[model samples]
Target: MKASRVASARSWLRTSNVPSDEYLEGIYYVQGRDFVDAGIVSSEIKKNLKEKGIPESIIRKVAVVTFEAEVNIISYAEQGTIQYYVEPGSITIEAKDIGIGIEDIELAQQEGYSTADDSIREMGFGAGMGLANIRKYSDEFEITSVPKEGTYLRSTIYVNGK
Candidate 1:
């Protein structure tokens, strides 16, 4: 099941969208147990982008990237924020959390390396693919964490695939 999810993410990244140069952006406040709320916000953004003539492919990338980031926060952080930016050159998705930060970012990035306990695992989440999927679907990715401070993850998907 995890393999299939990963494969599906890979497929999302493979699609291409027509390049845009206009700047667009949105911000979302993410709370724990609010995946549905996040999804609604994401869908609105996707719809807006599509109406603006942003290709479906690019919108899909934004959805996938944002969903992964949101899920990570929902599963791990007590609270967090997800920011979306649609620039002329690229789309940027950032997740910032105020909770126990990642102790080893390197290990966290590795596929199948998860810290989710039995409770989270029992829910069929925390396969440790969140960060990996975010990185895989993005053209540029960066992550930072401070023990007890929190974690910040950002991913950029270029409009022109640059």
Candidate 2:
């Protein structure tokens, strides 16, 4: 049963009117509650981008990158903020959280290092691949953390005018 849930095809997206660039640049906050809520928000962003005439390639590119942010917030923080910038040239997604906070940013970004407990591993999340996957798909990435303070993760996805 648990295995089935992890393997289920994940499609996160919803459609609404595409907001103007000025509006997209505004800050937004999303609370963390496991994977479900993050997935919903991610889907909406994808839909927003698609409505802006962003190509499939660019839309998917942004989706994968931000999905990492969504997962990071949901998995690590009790709540998170999505402050974003949707511009003509690129989209910047900033996901911030105050949680247990990463003690070692370097180790966390490694492809196989995670602090997630056993239960997280059972859900197929603690593969130590979250940050690595985010970097692999993003055009620019940076992470800053302070012990007991929280973490600030920012990623920039440039459309390359596709």
Candidate 3:
């Protein structure tokens, strides 16, 4: 397979009619050196989603997916950004990170597979369930990755869920 390409999120923003950068409520730069700071970033996501009028139920689901995705950046990647956007009837969460791309997405998606060190596990993550949970909670999901470049995850949870 060819290396995944980078797709600017401009199209989605334009399609949603929300200014590409205007819709972004908050941005977080997560690094491996500080897990607490990264964890705190979760609240920013929640606040923005709430302000967007996303249903509490759906927001909870989005939170699960977002937190899991953000933790992946913290544990594996050097640093990354978590961007938030609001659309007509949904909240979008995008995680972009520069890290060693997953060589086998199929294997990485397995519920019990993990490459995290003991330090991560002791912190209450790295149970190898982040991706699985992300898959479980996100209503719409897409992941693109490049070996030496990075990984990008886009997910949406509708405000009025089906």
lDDT of 2 by residue, 1-58 (tens): 5444433322222223345644454344555445544465667677677766777887
Candidates 2 and 3 compared: the better one by lDDT is 3
Residue lDDT tens for model 1, 47-160: 767777777777888888887777777677877777777777788888899988899999999999998776566655679887888888899999999988889998898877
What would the per-residue lDDT of candidate 3 be over residues 1-162, giving only the tens digit for each residue? 111111222111111233343354556666643454445556666766666565789878877877888788878886677776676677788889988877888888899899988767877999889888888888888888887677899888877886
Query: Each prediction's Cα RMSD?
Result: 9.1, 5.7, 8.7
Best-to-worst ranking by lDDT:
1, 3, 2
Ranking by TM-score: 3, 2, 1
- lDDT, model 1: 0.74
Clashing pairs in 1: 21-88
Off by over 4 Å in 2: 1-18, 21-23, 26-28, 33-35
For this target, which candidate reaches the highest TM-score against the unseen true structure? Answer: 3
Per-model TM against the reference: 0.78, 0.79, 0.80
Please list all clashing residue pairs in model 2, or write none if there are none.
12-43, 13-43
TM-score of 1: 0.78
